[model samples]
Target: MPFRPDPSLPVPPAGADPLPLQGLTLLLVDDSRFTCDALRLILHRAGARLRRAESLEIARLHLNCYRPDLAIIDLGLPDGRGEDLIAELSQMGFAVLGISGDPAGRDPALDAGAAAFLEKPLGSVAGLVRLIRQLTTGIGPVAKGEEVPVPAGDPMALRDDLARAARLILAPGDPAYARGFVQSLARASGDASLEAAVRDSGTPFDRARVARMIEDRLNRLRALA
Candidate 1:
């Protein structure tokens, strides 16, 4: 049975903690009515303005009507490949996050320039929030030359930054930033294999190892601070 989302429902509470996406409009692209409903609930709970689309064609229609700050796109859609939509949205300057049931399906989305890849039944709402915050706030212009210098001091902050960067690799609309973020993390962590993997796979070279290394590097940097 298809779940019909109540479009007339009032927005959820703002909550005690400040909503990261407060005041931002989000476009959610998915074929399933249930998925759209769930995501709308999440976004509504966070106080974000929500627009739902069931297919690429509908998404395009919504985009023409409203310019969203961010777009959450499902990899499979009835009209066409969602990767194509990601590319189109990137040109239009919308932040794109690709969500897929099959994690392996993330590859083409990443390649197409999605800002992040979120495997569905999205695990950590906080992580998604954090990634959104980072996307809205932390991203900067890509450095022109090779050998960009790591930001000085506060290893914990650096690690957090790197973690955000790792997540950004899956974002479909910002490949240049994603590439730079991965490269910077590799240089900061001084991990040869990590660097190699990032170069080879558009995804993080080794996620677990990179996480541990990020922790270790942050600790080392913190001891000095």
Candidate 2:
């Protein structure tokens, strides 16, 4: 029997048929710990095994040892654009899926050879399961009657992302990269105020202001913790 995921189990118990993605293996390339945590929960519930890479360098290292059935890459990374890695993975015969907060990234990601593109705030577990099935087998989505459960948001993971973004903002290197990282995280986590702040923060003075905002956000996350 195929294995389906049971969210209550840390790892699903053996001997029962699970969801459609039971035997599938996936690689996720993203820098946000919160994003990773969210995807991990979703994939876990679908009985898919997932491995994560936080940067291009780490992803390359993972690729050296093994190739997964699908590679889900975030458009932005701490090291470089995920488009480059997606193109390379596609050339290597891997089914590549690109994800990003910006809808504008969809065409570029597809042009880079991704088999499909998913926009972020990846909250829908059932939608994800159906999409994986379609991408891998050319089969249509599962029946609409199935009850799909959404994963609960991890506040601690969100806090970690906020803290990391704050640190990057205050750091001395690549101001553009820092700003972009914050913007990406803000959009991915559905923080419109933060996203707007980071988007408008082009100058050094503006970035400083955004940095302060990030710090404040981080503090708020901590208070809730």
Candidate 3:
């Protein structure tokens, strides 16, 4: 089940904007009413204009009518996978976060096109707030102004290679193959933080676990893109 906020928690002050989220519009895609209600309450309190859809069909309708700066999508939907939507939205210039109760297929989701991934039993609301802020405003520690030195190979060639690797791992397929593909890309990306985390966690390679790792990589790529 999707996580819900505690009702007893203090509510936002009347007429006061939720810090860091004011003036933002968000799209939420999920099949669960409870999930939408819980997220809507939090997002609304943060002063976001929230648009919601319970299926991809409905979400497409909203997308046609509204252009949201950010989207929070659940991986499982009655009609289709959220990762598919992520690819579509990312291409359209919207930042996306994929939330799932079962992280089982997360790796493929990230490969398919999520900017970030969050597991169910949600943790600190502060973290979500911070992530959204960084994604939308490009105002986080990771948003350093320093440029990434171009690699030795042709930039387009490298990008195509990376994209192919991502597709091999993220497209719907056998779980074992997807896990290996992501691990290979993570190593090739030369992201020390991600490599270190993967080493420390030592979790068995699976879609969900790999998705979390790939999501981090995707965020870095998005920054560079």
Clashes of 1: 9
- On TM-score, the candidate that comes out on top is 2
TM-score of 2: 0.87
| Alpha-carbon lDDT, every model | 0.62, 0.79, 0.60
Q: What is the C-alpha lDDT profile of model 1 across 137-185, one tens digit per residue? A: 6743222222222213234545555556545556455564444445434
Candidate 3: C-alpha lDDT: 0.60
Candidate 3 lDDT at 128 equals: 62
Q: What is the lDDT of candidate 2?
A: 0.79
Model 1 TM-score?
0.54
Q: Which sections of candidate 3 miss by over 4 Å?
A: 1-17, 141-225
lDDT of 2 by residue, 1-225 (tens): 112444564433253235668788888898887878777776776668888888999999988888788899998888899999999999988999899877788999999999999887664566777788788767787654334444545788888888888788778887767877788788777789989998888777877888788888888888887
Error of 3 at 225 (Å): 51
Better of 1 and 3 by TM-score: 3
Question: How much is the lDDT of residue 209 in candidate 1?
Answer: 49
**Candidate 2 positional error at 42, Å:** 0.9
lDDT of 3 by residue, 133-185 (tens): 77888876322222222222223433544454455544665544343333333
- Top-scoring candidate (lDDT): 2
Clashing pairs in 3: 103-208, 106-211, 107-207, 107-211
Ranking by TM-score: 2, 3, 1
Each prediction's number of clashing residue pairs = 9, 6, 4
Which runs in model 2 stand beyond 4 Å of their true positions?
A: 1-18, 146-152
